[model samples]
Target: MIPMRMPWRQGDVLDLASIGSRVDSLTDLSTIDGGPGARLTAVRTQAQAFRREFIETGTPDSVTTCDLVTLPYPTRFGLFRASRAIAPFLAITNRLLVIRWHESDGTPRVLLFEPSDVELGRYTPYFDKLAGRTPDVVSKRMVTEHATVLTHLARLRIDPSEVDYLMFDHLHTQDLRRWIGTTAPQPDLGEQPTPVFPRAKVIVQRDELAAMADLHPLQRPWYQPGTYRDVPPEAFLPIDGSVVLGPGVAVVKTPGHVFGNQSLVLNTATGVWVSSENVIAAECLTPEHSRMPGLARWAREWGQEVVLNANTIETTVDQYNSIVLEKTLADRSQRDSRFLQFFPSSELTASWTNPGTSPTFTHGAIAHH
Candidate 1:
């Protein structure tokens, strides 16, 4: 049906302007408003402009389908930190930003927000599973990013304290349960799991998450670099995505191999930049065949994965880093997290994608941390 669903394989090439025209859905933009009172206005005037640019550059023919789903802002979740984590700096910032996204009429809808510290780090049974783990502090790059968000919020005079949860609009139910020790109904499996966060909002669209799953480009042998491993039902959510943990930031679903696998998208003055979390290379969360309990099995089901980010978007990784590394920010050092110098071709690169080479659905992803 969808060209035999494959990971980042070479496909059609298109631009953003065409993509905008091809996709019927557009961002509501009202979500960006501070709250209900200000009369329905565009969420962020700045974001609206960025959206225009993003659509203008995307390629339509290369578009792949994503089964990714989306929810509202302020989705809450817990974040685990590892000292030797690949993106340790991003982990810290996760505490403040909630990355959420949604899909509407074949387009990806995204949003960013903040959550209260208590709501974000709520302890779950899974915490006991992470006995050997500890929290990750903010990296220099993260601090720089935080500073930028703060500057924007300050200029708007929005009190950060008002935020109770940095919710993500998207996440995998399996991963959600594992992270928070909550149970969800597996009607598909005729299994009833304990349901936690009865109040937590979840998006139930199927095709988008499925499309997102196809991005895992290369699968290696059980021991190779870009391969995938079978994950346990306990490890990931039925859906494929992650919630954002911080303010003005969100996590988008980038299914490579690992369940609960995610990519980070930061919204700054410069523009929106989605990170390639589990795409290409052995360093990704999902390595070649290395399945464990409590993870997403779809990762192994699909072959290797790749994230393609090959368009000349306004924001540059260098500029993004500079924004995060502002003097006022004292988070992690530049050495802490590796920042991209240039946006590589999706066809050539394993872990980066844009509208040109890959298919993406927009949605509201939560922010947390």
Candidate 2:
């Protein structure tokens, strides 16, 4: 028989105080210190620097290509509360990106951002509680067609082992050990290190890895324990600052949704596309507009500078700064254009079709700028 799982208790792993101390010990890349005040200061100083560097670096001369694939996943209507008034009840997709570019030396590189291949059954408990619906209700809402990451890759005729790099915006409900493997057997999975992408390297912020070990009690629900315990140190490409992956692709330390959260920025023919889960939709960035909803609208009414995703409030000020930095980066990329075209990762799915209609899968290449 399968072993029964024990309920998580306060001391089952680590205490709240210890978690906070661990987070404090993690390296923070921003100029400002760890409090809300420093985060607010970072909103102006660090965000400006982030924007300036990307603009000054200029787009790579080599042809850069990108495409968005909407992977099927379980999502609640309430998650997109801002747009609930418009559509009421609807399903959404987990937007994933496939990026291809060449280095200065002309070596071909392939990167996958949030290659989510989650099993809904594994997360049924969280979905049931989050949507305040029964198991039956949740099951009916989940879209199963074209769900797995392998199927999408198969359609593209690309092999997972050929991938050069893999990244996630944060560690929320992710199990990278399955893909990258570990040095020893994982507690939950009694399996040795068996990497799915044999040659690929996983890139993550060092601060994020630290935060995962000792998460805030409130933030614990979104992470899986022992997920990274077995991952060999050499397999990880942990960064403390912005890292240029290729000529036109860079992973910038945004740090808002989580203490170690980061965003992927790519210079595309359309414009700079930022792959991030920090905000649910593009509307979150334009809080000044009246049509903006939820925390964004509230922020505008309260005369706040920016709005955030409202997932983790451990660092509210830092989240605000991260959002501002995203906006600045998008703005600088479009200085010559008449309007903005910053693509929120989710927008790729939500904007694909009208609400209540079946999803129409689409794909395209992001030509060189």
All candidates' TM-scores?
Answer: 0.26, 0.72
Best by TM-score: 2
Off by over 4 Å in 1: 1-93, 98-110, 113-122, 131-253, 257-272, 275-338, 341-369
The alpha-carbon RMSD values of the candidates against the true structure, listed in the order shown, are 19.1, 7.9
Tell me the deviation in Å of residue 344 in model 2.
2.8
Q: lDDT by residue for model 1 over 33-145, one digit each (tens)?
A: 56432312222233344334443332211111111111111001101111121221111122223233322344333222222222222232232223224334411211212
TM-score of 1: 0.26
Across 1-369, the per-residue lDDT of candidate 2 in tens digits comes to 222221122232223221111112112545455776666555556555655555544464433223323323332222333332344333434555777666655776778787654652245334436545546554444433444666667876779878888888876766777677777786566568588888787677777766665666767666764455557666666666566666557787777678878887776655566657666545456544424224345655577744455545667666777776677666522432422344545442443223532222212223453
For model 2, the stretches where C-alpha displacement exceeds 4 angstroms are 1-52, 55-92, 120-125, 128-133, 142-145, 184-193, 290-299, 332-339, 347-369
Q: Which 10 consecutive positions of candidate 2 have the poorest summed lDDT?
A: 18-27
Q: Among all windows of ten consecutive residues in candidate 1, which has the lowest summed lDDT?
A: 70-79
